[model samples]
Target chain A: MPGIEDLYREIILDHYRTPRNRGELPPPAVYSEGNNPLCGDDIRIYLDVADGVVRDVKFSGQGCSISQSSTSMMTVAVKGKTVAEVQAFVRRFKHMMTLTNESETVDESVKLGDIEALQGVVKFPVRIKCATLGWNTLLEALTEAIK
Target chain B: MVTTLTEASHNMSFDSAVIRRDFPLLAKQIDGKPLVYLDSANTSQKPNAVIDAMANFMRESYAPINRSAYTLAANATEQYEGARAAVAKFINAKSAREIVFTKNATEALNLIVSSWGRANLKTGDVVLLTHMEHHANIVPWQMLQQERGIELRWVPLTSDFQLDLTSLTSLLSGVKVFSFTSMSNVLGTINPVEKLCAAAHAAGAISIVDACQSVPHSPSDVQSWGADFATFSGHKMCGPSGVGVLWGREELLEAMPPFLGGGNMITDVRLDGFTCAELPAKFEAGTPPIAEVVGLGAAVEYLTNIGMANVRQHEISLSSYVLDLLTNRFGDDITIHGPRNPELRGATFSFAFRGIHPHDISQILDQSNVCVRAGHHCAKPLMKIIGANATTRASFYLYNTTTDADTLADALDSASDIF
Candidate 1:
């Protein structure tokens, strides 16, 4: 079992303490809301897209550490990526999070970035929802952008 | 059976080392620290009494309750009825016929709304609920609302987390069925059911009390409260899982259609139609949680031997001690939700330390072997009402102590620093 040290490394806490892209985007954006009804986690993801690119992204909500930190990390991951690339990353992130060792592999080159820290989540099944809340919002917002 | 309020309070105490021995888990250490479990409002730990009661039934007299025309069958049926009777006595229900076993309190709540609400509630009727309800109480009615087009009305909670009775009066007029928690599992608010039931009746609404949190800790008399129905779980009171009690008025149970119909729930079956089994049997379909019901019966007996008045007083005193400990140690670093007074609350208190997410606090507390609940706690609307994503909660039972509270306080201080 990977220890909490792997998940709560200084990098993860830094993103949580000083979140990047922590504000609202302007109008003409696809907006989506994802709430973990069981745990009281609510986050609103807003995306600024023009011509198949995510120009900017922002989110705001109240939740526990794994959720809010996950959201903060998600905002940083997708901010500068193209719309299609972000969607693929969402699928890859979800697959990696499910931690199916036989069926999934993450690109250690991209480093899994801030998300690599969340590997400790797989050991705690109840907390898997906490780690995925923000990622689900990313999917929701992207779907809205595609439509 | 009801004691005066003062007497009940006076007889309860915070010094209960003997009670701690009853719970085997309380003595152990977690992560090299003594286990300070305060999540009873979620689900309580089982004592030997409940465990032995279940093991005893499985070993001495374990048989299916359905008809088999044998000695074992008769014994099994008797034990099942005995459990129903025990449940009725525990909650002061009018008859054992009124007790229906469910999978959990959530399923019990669903049965009432789906079965009773469908037959009685019509379009444009309002189902009044509080914002602080567990999703079990909210979502089932929302399903009904979608079908029947019933208005989903909220009895807004006050800023401090108490039910806004002033707002409730206006919403109660159109309400056909009123469902609410006797005590919030998360907020620990103790609502006055007798008075609330009175108002709901005056407004011509049937009251359904979600006693999931209250019944396990306090002595309850559903008959005196004049509630049409009340729901609670066995797991929360140290009984085994897959067993919950839905105590409704006898007439209401008889009148409502069978929630789920299968072999055991049917009296007569034909190609054309089926005659449903009477009263309690009609609602409980398929095989029931036999061993669990027996365990719940033992739980009632155990609580009775300890005295419910004593149990409730112990919880309040422990809650107050923790409240004071948090105030003295953390002070402004801690922001507490719900009423400051333990009297106004159940055993649970939702709070947050500034700059520390609940997951962080809970994880840190876990390092100290302190078991608490973190997250929305199945009370999101309440969470939104309180203005937080999540909060750390420590709920107690009769077995908890002030020493446990002190440890929790110390853990919070460390957690605040850890975050």
Candidate 2:
């Protein structure tokens, strides 16, 4: 059985206590919001994209430590990456959290950085939605930006 | 021999050990620790009596009811109808024909909305509901408002979370239907049913009570409440799932159109139209939950033996103990989201502890084998009104003891140490 410590690691707690890139972006920023109404976890993703690359990204939400800290880590990871790179990162991060395939192993190619700490969220089926709310909202913002 | 209510009420004392023994799940352990269940408001743990009643019925006389005329089918039909009579007597309805068995309390409430609201309500008519109603009560009316262009009025809450009836008259003005919960599933505040019903009558509106939370934990008399319709589920009352009771006035049930049309609900089916059946059968559209109804009947008998007044007294004492313990121990660190008076509320306590998320608190409590519910509790509007995303709810029933409260407090202390 996975313990609570596994779900709330020290690094995750640090990110939650002092979140990074938490605020609004200027005009022409790509923005989208997502919320898990069941848990009352809400996330608004704001991104500044220039030249097919994320110039800046920020997230603000009120939720459990898992959701807020994961958003903080996600913002740090995808800030300067290209839109394609961020999309790939989102896919890999979601794969790591879901691990839905039987024959699929963890792909070592995708360097997850601080977001890897959230892999333990797979153990908690309910909180997986909380941890992924920010990433899902970011993808939506990216799509809106492209449109 | 069945104990009379007077005899049962005379001995108002509760024996938690004896009551706890009735439920076998209470004796189980989780993670090597004894189970400390405090989530009765969500759904109750079934006693052996209910389980055996269902199992024995299924084994001996389980057959399709209301269709076949064989001896076995007759026995099953008798058992099923007997359950309805038991429910009618349980809530003191005028006749058993007023009680219609549905899938669950949600379905029961939906039956009222779809049958009565669709038939009687037209565009621009107003329906009054309380802010503290569970989604079951709120969503059905909202569905009607969207489809039929009806207006919805809300009875707001006082600062302390009770219904603010200061604007009761204005809110009830021109309302065609007044529907509300008898108790708040999230706040545990018991509404003044009699007064609310009288107000609805005074405003010339039909009164409906969502007695889901109240019916199980305390005595429920739709006649005494003077509500035209009331609903509750068997699963919440120490019975099996897939069975619920909808008790409506005979005249209203006779007048309303059928909510669902199928095998058992119609009197005659033609190419163009259909004539509906009588009161209870008109609402019961299909093959009903026969075994579950037997279990519900046994649950009613069990609660009658225990006496609802005694159950309420037991809960009052338990709530007082819990309030004193949690407050005196944690002080301002804990914020219980209900009226402080035990008499004003049921034993449900939705609280925020030391700024910890309710999910985190529930997870920590789970480690100590302390079961609680964490989330919006299907009452998102109430959660939003209370200004919280979610809350950790710990509710009690007759089987709970002061020891369970102590276990919960200790578990909370453990949670705080980590958070």
Candidate 3:
């Protein structure tokens, strides 16, 4: 039984309070919207991809701390990485989120960094969608950028 | 035993502690903390009478209803139809024939839209709805709109979250049907059903009241309300799930086409077409939720024994307590999104606390075993009107006490500390 402290860690709250890349991007940037209709969590991911390398990322959304902070953390983690690298990171982050038990270990190859704080979300299955809303939107944005 | 409990409740002043004892789940503890359930508007915890009735029916009298000629089947049919009678009496319908059992209130509303809306409404026909209706009421009409090209009109809300009916007559102009909730599930604002129904009648539009929220907490008289049709769910009224009631005027029900086609809904089937069954059976298409219906009957009996007036009185006091407690304690931090007056509302309250998102608030509240609902509450149009993506809703019921409200305030204090 993980407590509220585990889910709303200080790091997650900090990211929620002061989000990173919290604005929209101009033309030449691909964007995709993601919505969790169940909870009314809406996220729009704006991506600036150049020659297979992710140049920049930004997110704008209104949702709970888990969702908004995850979006903020997502923007920071995926920026300045290759598109493939970002894709790998998303897979790892989702894998951590889908883990039923908090004790479950992730693959040693991919490091989640601050996004690992959201692993506590797996304990609260309903909030897992909130934590992954941004990552799913990023996936959609990446799919659009590749096209 | 049930009778004694009911008599005790009726004889004594409204006591939530005594009422809470009837519901088994209220006794449950999470992480050594007592369960403070404030989400009765979502679905109520079933009382022992309803639970036992359902279980007893399944154990002894479980059989095919209205199909077999066996003694057991007759008994089962009697119980099922008895439930319909109970529901009819509960809402003061003219006859049990006016009541049609469906899967849930959503299904009941959909049945009306598909059957009556399709039969009566033509292209450009307008259906006036309120901003407070749940998706069940709205989406069915929308689906009809998409298919039939009918126009949809909305009755907006006042600043105080009540229906702004100042221009209702003008809005009711050219409207074929006026469908709205008797009580707003999100805002807890009680709509004036009798006034709305009369206005619809004067405008030559039939009124349909979604009484899902109002019926459970308060005494409902559809006849006095003069609503052409009314629908509600059993689950929200301390009965089992998988059952809902749709009560319509007998004449209107007779005129409408059947929504679902099956064995029970038909009188006789030929090679080309089939003759629909009479009145209620026309709408009841298949083997209905027999046990759940029995449980619903028990629930109705339980409420009747205790008296709906007492239930309403208890809720009114609870609402006043919660409204004052939350407002006075939280002050500028809490924003309760409903009318400040407790007399004009049910106990259901949707609120936003200190800019903290509803999901986070509910999550922290969950830590203290304080159950509440946090989301759009399936009223997205209302949510948009309120300028909130989502709101934390803590709905009280007859069984809820001021102690629960105090626990909610205490837990909210903890939420503020964490955030």
Candidate 4:
């Protein structure tokens, strides 16, 4: 059995308490909102993509530690990466959170880093939505930006 | 404005410890700790009586009902219809024919909006609903609005979380159907059913009561409420899932078209068309949930034995204890939504703690085996009104005791420690 500490890791709490890239991006940025209707967790992701490079990314929302922290870590991870790289990272992060089988292998190059702390969330199936709300919104914003 | 725990307990009619023993799940241990279930508003824990009744029916008399004439089939049909009679008597309906069995309360509400609403409401007709209704009550109306071009009116809430009835007459003025919940599933605010029903009647609108929250927790009489139709789920009332009751006025049910078109709903099916069956059967299409209804019958009997007055009293005392303990312990750190007076509310408590999110609070509470719900509780509009995105809810039933409240408080301390 996993303890409460496992779900709310120290880094996750730190990110939740003092989030990075917490505000909106400037104009010319594409934005999208995602909501976990059951938990009332709503997040809006803002993206600034210029010439295929991810120039800036920010998020603003109210959610639990997992979601807020995951979003904070996601912004830090994807700020300097290219649009294609961030898209791959999003897929990798979702895969890590929803680890369908223990035997399934994760690509080592798409490093999750601090976001890997949220792997414990897979145990609590209900909180997986909380952990992924920000990432899903980020994905939507990226899609909107390319369009 | 706070009642003492001693006074509250003294006023209660039954001992919760004794009632707790009737439910086997109350004895369950989670993570090596005794389970403290406080999510009765979501769904109640079933007692041994209901479990045994369902099991017994399956073993002794389970058969396809209302379609066969064999002795065994007749016996099964008798038991199934007997559940309908129990439901009818439970809600004080005029006749058993008024009770229509659907999959659950959601389906029951959908049945009304599709069947009765479609027949009566035309384009531009108004249907009034409250801000605090569950999605079951709201979505059905919204579906009708889009498909039939009907309009929806909302009755807002007061600052104290009760329904703001000052403009109710104006809200109901052009309304063809006035649908609302008897008690809020999240806020626990008990609405004035009879008064609202009268207002709806005076305005020439039919009243529909979503009694899913009220029927299980308190004494409910549809006739006394004067509601044209009332619906509730057996699962929320200590029975099994897959069965719910929709009690409509006999005349209205007869007048409306059937919601579903299938086997048992029709009396005669020719090559070209079909004639619908009688009142209850017309709404009850295809194979009904026979054994679940038997369990619901047993659930009603079990609740009757405990006495609804006593059940309501138990919850009142429990609610008082929860409010007193949580406030006294957490002080300004805690914020409980809804009326402070126990008389004005049910046992449901949706609250926030410090700055910790509801999911975190619920997670910490689960460590001590205290089960609570943390979400919008299917009332997004009400959540918006209350100024909370989500709230951690701990709802009590007749089986809950002050010890459960203590466990919940102790668990909260752990949550605060984590945050």
- Model 4 CA lDDT for position A59: 91
* Candidate 2 stretches greater than 4 Å from native: A99-107, B1-8
Between candidates 1 and 2, which one is better according to lDDT? 2
| Top DockQ model | 4
Model 3: per-residue lDDT, tens digit, A48-95? 999999998998979899999999999998889998888878878878
Q: What is the C-alpha lDDT of each candidate?
A: 0.83, 0.90, 0.91, 0.90
- Candidate 2 on B1-419: residue-level lDDT in tens? 11246755676656987899999999998678889999999999999999999999989989999889899999999999998899999999999999999999999999999989999999999999989999999999999988999999999999988999999999999999999999999999999999999999999999999999999878888888999999999999999989998999999999998998898999899999999888799998888888999999999999988888888877887899999999999999999999998888999999999998898899889888899999899999898899988899999998999999999999999987776
Q: With candidate 2 superimposed using the best TM-score fit, by how many Å does residue B89's alpha carbon deviate from the native? A: 0.5
The digit string of per-residue lDDT tens for model 4 on B268-329 reads 99999999999889998889888999999999999887777777777787788888998899
Looking at model 3, residue A143 earns an lDDT score of 94
Report the C-alpha lDDT of model 1 over A53-125, residue by residue, as the tens digit. 8888998876766777878888888877887678667767777688336655544434467687777777767
Reference contacts reproduced by model 3: 0.83
Order of all candidates by DockQ, from best down to worst? 4, 3, 2, 1
* Alpha carbon deviation, residue A10, candidate 1 (Å): 1.4
Report the candidate with higher DockQ, 1 versus 2. Answer: 2
| Candidate 3, CAPRI quality class derived from DockQ | medium
In candidate 4, position B250 carries an lDDT of 94
After best superposition, candidate 2 residue B358: deviation in angstroms?
A: 0.9
Global lDDT for candidate 2?
0.90
